[model samples]
Target chain A: MAKEKTSALHENKGVSQPKDTNTRAIKNIRTKRNTKLNTKALVASILKSDTVALSRAITLIESNHPSHIKQANAIIKACLPYANQSIRIGVTGVPGVGKSTFIEAFGKYLTSKGKRVAVLAIDPSSSLSKGSILGDKTRMEALVKDEHAFIRPSSSGDSLGGVARKTRESIILCEAAGFDVIIIETVGVGQSETTVHSMVDFFLLLKLAGAGDELQGIKRGIMEMADAVVINKADGDTLKHAQLAKVEFNKALQLYPIKASRWKPKVMLCSALQNEGIDSVWKLISDYIAITSKNHYFEKKRQEQNKFWLIQTIETQLKSHFFNRPDIKKELEQQLELIKANETTPFAAADYLLNL
Target chain B: MAKEKTSALHENKGVSQPKDTNTRAIKNIRTKRNTKLNTKALVASILKSDTVALSRAITLIESNHPSHIKQANAIIKACLPYANQSIRIGVTGVPGVGKSTFIEAFGKYLTSKGKRVAVLAIDPSSSLSKGSILGDKTRMEALVKDEHAFIRPSSSGDSLGGVARKTRESIILCEAAGFDVIIIETVGVGQSETTVHSMVDFFLLLKLAGAGDELQGIKRGIMEMADAVVINKADGDTLKHAQLAKVEFNKALQLYPIKASRWKPKVMLCSALQNEGIDSVWKLISDYIAITSKNHYFEKKRQEQNKFWLIQTIETQLKSHFFNRPDIKKELEQQLELIKANETTPFAAADYLLNL
Candidate 1:
């Protein structure tokens, strides 16, 4: 197989050879190797909280410029020993649930308690615009000014789940940088919430106080995956409704089978704008960790999550590769139209496309 | 690719060079071609309501006798024009919802209305049996005795979804066998429900009325996919509760986005044993067809379904082929264990495996 790949690459090169092509290829390969080595050294320095090196390393990893993945892998290897020390939390909610506002207030509370906090926001829509709401540091003024807090908004390009992959890798980098907590904030779409939950230690679902129909609109699968539920914006006139909504949610959650950890998820009310109940939210998560770790379920769960992700990543990549093949793409489109016209069955169409 | 495969076959023939091996290979190729022709002929006879040929054709399709897939595709192609004329309804609910009993009663109703009915029961647990529950036709004595009703049960397989694929193909065969209505009965398991829904024209979710946590136990996504919600066993003491459940489901359905058909799904009560409200359920389906067809949504939805199955089938086959490659298996397993240990990110592991 390796020989086959090499031969294919050579064949490609043979087809494209022109003046300076060989020299350009050699130069490209050398630069890629050097970039990888530099990124590794930069990552090691960042572990000691060198902000300048950390920023540069992240920029190199995020770039689509040549050899970005090679450099990214090297940096990740160097940072491995210092990573996995933090509590990874993922927060998601429906649109208009004040997710950004809540995160700013929550980050401030963690920093106040002498904890170094890292925030990675994944906004799927920002992929095209590359302009994220959280990218504007002024929006999160309090936490942004805190020396212990670091907030990096999502980058452009890729699916919501792709943004999640980058954020997950960033969490390891942040943990290596001595951050005690890594918070992943996702765009409040249902599909994105599932992606965020798969990568985090604890998944927090936020809800508005009195959104009756909105509660129903949220899929129960998303709710069942939640480790903690926070009724956000629970202040003043919304206080009574928040309490009621909490009870309803608790009742709904009771229908699900007990989670593997055997710990019943906690439901709490929080006013993210007023900074109320922010401490309680962190305390609940600490309690959850303590309980699961004592039972040795924490390590087991994380290991299982890693296995899930490994299979998922392979499947996704293989699908992309298969679809990207020029011949397969054209055949697939033609066969689809044939099936639509009832000139063929899906099974036969599949056989033909796969053989092609 | 075709030339390579043919050459590989020629190489195998050369290497073996045994009289018995040569004879067996010749026989195998002959049986494959013969089966294909047989299936094509069987499809025509089946459409004329030749029950014996229909049974034999399905047996030839489901057999693992080396020539099955070729024969299956031939039968499917011959049946293509006749299939899709029937309303393919997929029914699922929890165990107590009485799926088998409901199917028996429902089949009887359709047969009585002069609509030849076919019931295909997909039991995920059948993987170990290599046999079907329909062998005990006594369980559905009334429907089994009806000249217009036919019942076939699940086939053993490695994957639940794979088993479903064959069953769906069998549905097309049954439609060609002059069955005007095909009811696919699947187990109540959530994952299997999605598989069955993807292949059918309409999905009916059956629920027992007295279940206290009905709304919470069934995910909203399942409800959204359902074209109708039936509160089954709605006789005698359960009548009032069934009515209440119907109202609850109706309210829940309102929260979902309107289905593409723009024909609002209805909630109804039925007692399959008592044979109550079966006609009304049929009427509701007919009404749905009429409204959706009038607006041209029916053909559009069918086209989208065809495209979905075409892509899904291709992806499934590609994954299976890639994983089944002998040389890659051991390395893949080793990498998986490393991934489980968190020694490497899933993305990096996938890159290593695919590029290996």
Candidate 2:
């Protein structure tokens, strides 16, 4: 009776939805791997297409430690010159819309064409969802096992801005590692879609044809951000429905002014499971690149994206510094009450906080 | 010049596009009217429904001088208790879509029904466009003379955020002056439409019956923000076209999910010049208010709006302070060059600036 069994849960032996408790081991590994690595060697290895070095550099980038951050910055700067030649495309869709399968087929197509492919994700909800984006090794087992492909889950962060910045930086690392095509995937939530759109050369939206109401669950402004909208699962009973959705989407796209890229967004039908329509999707993207390059829109758009990111980054930091102050957080609640009670104007309340 | 006299241009006596040289008179008037007025007295006068006091308060808010800002803040805080009772409606359209005429007809209709109306504008481009919004005193002759109606031109500022803040404060003073209906007019430009949409209770979009492309000039997110889409000038030759346009617009609006207010935006035909269909617009708005109030979305949206404005103001100020610093401004340009040349990542650049 006195020799009762100790709880395995307290000893970390019980494995049920485990997280947050084992970060010590991971932190130790990060420190051991990163302590002696200089930025120049990392850049040289990545430039030579060393996959292990590429993965380690990304780990340094995804690290929140100050020393890792300094190293990641130097490596990113050194690798930037080698990063501009790859085609960085973004793919987005809802949760159950077969993103993993479509991505597998598409990556395999690219790899079979003698091209190296890299798949990265920008899931802001990854932490809560347990890194679900590209989390399961079996989801795209073929793509993962392909020697010419690299897949990485999203970087966990307290904010989408932080996650997006990390993902955006990781793109440069992948490109420098000699990936011919880099696919950044995001779920079809609003802010993340906009973030991915700003960073990518082309954006592809995947949809499932509905019984009716083809627009359901589609966030506002998403249909406009898309360079091409693909109706997935068009091979079975949903073929006719997918055709109808194509018409509906075309009409909806017509409602928007033509993009500055001078490329009209298209609606295509695809069957990822059957591996149908995958070639046409690649062709559509290639045609877009060719046309935009001829008109000089492709280079101009990349320059614009760079400027946009720089400005956006500064603004986010400025706001974050102010909002995270201990006194400001305490005072904001009191001001909100005053605002609801009609005793202070919002601008006046803001002034009070700024002065504090 | 023949007599060796000074030229009219040099003497500021020419009848040309004169600006930036004749502000003395206006500044003197502002100082004379506002220097001695206290916040409590101004609030009392506004509560007594003094239009002159309300106008003066708005003029103070529009001033950029430090003393004027201090006084304006006090007055706005004092007037807060009397605000939040009015129904604010935002009307927006392209330049040629006849906004002035529609607003005039709508304002007259409200006054005729014994409702006190106040019309305000939020044109960020007012400084460049010479205050075209409500600038022409003759544009709404009947409504301008209506005893129950008050119309004010947009407040001019170098930034949209500045102008929007001024207009938002003016809204409180107008409500305190006993106006039951406040109409905020904004041109269908992207940022201004969003700013107006955030401040008002209802957003009305005015559209022309296009030759074929009905959604031609509508901005990307404007349609989603609209509570109602009115096909203006639906008389004479365009009458049949307006009917077809109504069907087109109805289809377009249906594409958007229902709003948080649970209101389905409607498409109606109106001839502002002929004063037709004006009452229906009012009836539609009343119906919207009734439903939203029943669902408590009306109150909830306003509360959310207040909290949103509070945070927005703080963020805007934080950004402005950071960007306006002389050292930061100089370094930002240099950082942009580095970013374009791919010598640094945006996040790293931002951190450098933040530390500086």
Candidate 3:
């Protein structure tokens, strides 16, 4: 595997047994001497499935420094040829559904099956925590110790769109790093889930069996986006409730029309703590990927997602440019006040502003 | 009632009455006669609840002739001060759901209770029909003759956003004309329902008891916008099905989180043909309005809707401006191809285009 070569290269770094070792690869002298890191060398190592090089490249992508922009784009362009090979899955649930534990167990299960798994998160409100609140080594201890598993926290402090874009780019790097399966986890509180949903091939919504109370904290319109709903923590006293919730959710899902993909969303019950049903969840995903791939919906959806992201990126940038203009900003405030006072219609105000 | 004056004015026209009558009002000079139809006179008459002036002004608003633009804006400006006084309810249902018959019966019921009613529609695909397929005069035979009821088909031959904007402006005209209840009707398919939902104070989704087949043909994410879902055609043998559907929908709704209105959406069974449960549907809207108004959510939602429209209009216009540019259009096509080939990331392409 590509990863084994990366590991061998790292181990033979300074005390090289062969003369070709130093000449065969770019030296790590740049890293040790605090000089500019070689972008080509990083990309080469990342393509070889070097975890350290991949992580450093992602940091470059996330950096705000203008000088890093060119190098980051270069690294991404180099990795693009090797990206999009992995199946991307997005998992979302409100806080307290034991997402970290679920991901840990799921990641460990996949690693045991010899599948390289990469877990990334999208948390819009985690600027204070910097990255994944659940990504602490203590939270995912087993996965943290696994050589076949990689878990990265959410990028902090930027806009949700910014973080989402970075996470999307990072997915490309991880895939180039030879991760076979990529999982994106987002909190269901705000708009992050929708962002993650747009970038992934399949979306899984996690839920608890709190009956009606479980739906309270979740935002509206998200349930319809789920490709599957898994009732988590279904053990002991909650087992019956989880079973009932699964039945109820299936019934509710039947009320929705089949999506264009012709894939009917399923509802399942699981106990991540006990490691029960995790295999079934993985099987469901594998089955979904197999069917979608056979039917060509998988590639079609990825192309569509790519197009959507292009249009969305342009729109976001255009909007930011318009709103950030000092002149428009002042005029917009006045227009908002006039609208609040009912002195003018929004259409008329928009007309005036656009003309201005 | 203000409608009485409108009725009297039509009756008094062309009569050899007192000499002061001529001086009391401005003549309709723009009627190709030697006299000028005073704009102020039209505004005054509309404010006096003159249905003739109201209908003419709405026609002006709907006209695409460049000459009509100034007059339409003037009319909307005149009506703005008196608008926002009525409760705007949006009604939507798929074909065969009996929306027209329901609206006729509901309008008649309201007029019988001494409340003037105005019904309008939003049909994006109706450019082919040039208006509401349901608003055919023969279909709404009773409403066509009812003095206290005003029914207008959709504004035809425009985009959904254009039609929705016109209809929203028409709502203001109706309110200013003393129609105390305004209802905007739309087909459930496509994007019309969402446009109507955004403009109205309350949204009611009409459905037929199709077991589960009813959800087909309707787009996803619309059901979540409904303030109430009414099972229509609940008469004769279908009554049992409608009742069952009501219960099923109620259960399905429970799976969704409560809306921001903090009001639970109700499912009611109504037979527009038999006029059964029609009053109860009205009661639901009244209760909704009463509760939302008391809690100030009514006004808050209206303000938010206003703000939303303002930003949406600006964004839509900005997008059209960007996409319509020949330079940008050429670049966009090339960028789309590159994205399809995975030769470039969306963010990078967007940056390239925006700088252009």
Winning model by TM-score: 1
Tens-digit lDDT string for candidate 3 (A93-127):
87888898898899999999999999988898787
The fnat of each candidate, in order, is 0.65, 0.88, 0.83
Residue-level lDDT of model 3, residues B279-322, one tens digit each, is 99999999999999999999999999998999999999999999
Model 2 misplacement above 4 A: A1-34, A37-44, A95-98, A156-158, A206-219, A229-258, A264-296, B1-34, B37-45, B95-98, B207-217, B229-255, B263-295
Kindly report which residue pairs in candidate 3 clash with one another. B29-B35, B29-B36, B29-B37, B30-B37
- DockQ scores for all predicted structures: 0.42, 0.54, 0.47
- Clashes in predicted model 2: 0
Q: Which should have the higher TM-score, number 1 or number 2?
A: 1
State in Å the error of residue B28, model 3. 22
Model 1 docking grade: acceptable
* TM-score list, all predictions: 0.86, 0.80, 0.77
List CA RMSD, all candidates.
12.4, 10.6, 13.4
For model 1, how does the per-residue alpha-carbon lDDT over B20-118 read when each residue is reduced to its tens digit?
658888997897777656766787788898878888877766776655666667777888888778888899887667777788888888887889988
Error of 3 at B71 (Å): 2.7
lDDT of 1 at A89: 92
